[model samples]
Target: MNRRQMTFIILVNALVSLLIVLLVTWIVELRRPDPEELAALYTPAPAVLLAPTVTVPVETLPVVGGDAQATPDTGTTQAEGDETVYVVQAGDSLLGVAARFGVTIDDLVQTNNLANPDFVFSGQRLIIPATGQTASPNATTQPAAPGEPQIVAVESAGNLADEAVLIVNESDNPASLAGWRLEREGGPTYTFGNVQLFAGSSIRVYSTSGEDNTIALYWGQLDPVWRAGAVVRLLDGDGVEMMRQVIP
Candidate 1:
């Protein structure tokens, strides 16, 4: 071959080899993905922790989770602010009378001291104690007029500061405060769900089973209530109040 022809041949051969190399590289790239690729884009986030819920420690379960409570009854029947007294009339059995009024037998007996359930005489005025709302056997002193029911005030107080309030019963009524509720207002009437009383409250005797039982109540810093002229009444089962004392 001539020199010029040989040179031309070498250049053509180099160009062809370069093209072949590129084509092979492209073919090798056309492959299926690997089965085990690491997950890099979407990593999971950690879970967050929260504080436990605060509940009232009373006889019944704490029912104040966003529940609108206007009045405070430690397990009394008196609706928000209603109270009354009933007289034991003729033809009244303890069970029959209690059932008619929608109150427990124990509550009726506690309100009215019946030494002998069978021995109650006619026309003996007795306290019928308060409940949510139900019929009565002729109640006396309705709230505003002759037909309206009386409104009784129930005061509940608790401490934001951790401290136990000593309880004393005025009427000696048997009360269990395993599931109760309390609210406290601080810095602009803010209410907080609470467990027990703050520091001090008026303790009185509870009239339970013909006996006087005392209980501890924690309202708040006792001094603030006493200064505010608040009143707390310890009532009997018959709705007859045993004692009414200014918070002191």
Candidate 2:
């Protein structure tokens, strides 16, 4: 119980207390979570995979009639053997089609068996008859002889209101046009009613709906009956072709 003995006892107690505090701090550090391991557990993963991009090319169609240039407003034409085939385009009339191929309207109607000669739709195939070829079995009319009434000229402006055909009587006597027929090839026909043409006198036939007179006769047509290159025929009362003139 002396002073030296008491000092030694206090030193031994302090050493034991210090050893216990170090052991507690070491145990707490081992139980705490690591920063790298906690970040890996909370990170998000992707939901879907990305797809690859692709491209495709378009195709084009070839033109008809081989290398023939397309005509403006008019359709294209192709030759097959000795015949010419014309494909109808948009805004094509039967009169215009006949004129373009230099064929008569009756030739078109008889060759194609057209139920309605005034109606021709787009993309329709038309077989053009050759020049001087007969249309039907009953088309036996011949051209007019000399010293008869002749179709002198055709003034066609591509409109029904302004289209006209001129006929002149070159004989010495006055000829009667009564019961005479003015035919538009395969289209409607205009018959004269009690009309007379004097010697060396001329008359005009219009292709429009109007009152008829001595000099000018109207065909009463809704559309134009004449076009460029169309054939205009003048027939007698017996269905004989008196004159044939092509529109310019």
Candidate 3:
């Protein structure tokens, strides 16, 4: 072979070898994965769990003076401006409530505007005036006329032996109770005989049997004549109603 041809053959073989090495390096670089992509494939996502919803309940209270049904011995009191609101319990009377709150019957009557001072019912709401507070002017019950007799109180009315009705004579002149009748509606009647209730004096007529006296008289009844929620009327000899009171 010639010297020039041998040189040409060596040059061509070196160029082919260089081309093969560059092709192999490009193929290896294309197959290799990126750092961020490799980490995303192996690492797991964070777990998420939802919680359930919840509910609650609420309580309600009875409004004052709204409910008319009375509970026995169960009463509620609330303070108002310059006064107090009291709920009347079963078997409560005007006298008993007045004595309990250290107020007078006139105070209760004027504040509540009661048409009849002798009548009070359970579940009634009464506004008690504060100390030194003036009574309301909207009173429904007027004071008795001068020189008039009145029924003041009825105490322990449901009790057989302890029940009594009080009668007061506010007249300037002496009052006669003779031939008068004490009637219990739908029940019994008691008649007075030769009795004289003097002016500015009081007397108690008891339900149970006992001897007649100056300050007290007996009905001679075996059972209780005056019960809770009973209407007692005082009638004259001419069958006229002088005064009336309700047992509490």
Number of the candidate with higher TM-score, 1 or 2? 2
Best model per lDDT: 2
- Residue pairs in collision within model 3: none
Off by over 4 Å in 2: 1-143
Query: TM-score rank, highest first?
Result: 3, 2, 1
Candidate 2 lDDT tens digits, 80-183: 67677788888777765664554555678988899998788988888887652212212333446777776654554366777777676767788888888987
Top-TM-score candidate index: 3
Tens-digit per-residue lDDT, 184-233, candidate 1: 11221111122222222123211112222233233434222221233333
TM-score of 1: 0.21
Candidate 1 regions exceeding 4 Å error are: 1-82, 132-248
What is the C-alpha local distance difference test score of each model? 0.39, 0.72, 0.72
RMSD of each: 22.2, 16.6, 20.6
Per-prediction TM-score: 0.21, 0.41, 0.43
Give the per-residue lDDT digits (tens) of candidate 3, residues 1-248. Answer: 89999999999999999999999999999999998899978968788878987776767666678866655644656665646777888777776566456455667898889999777788788887574221122212223345656566566666778777767676668888888888887789999888887755667789999998998899988888776567778888888777665554
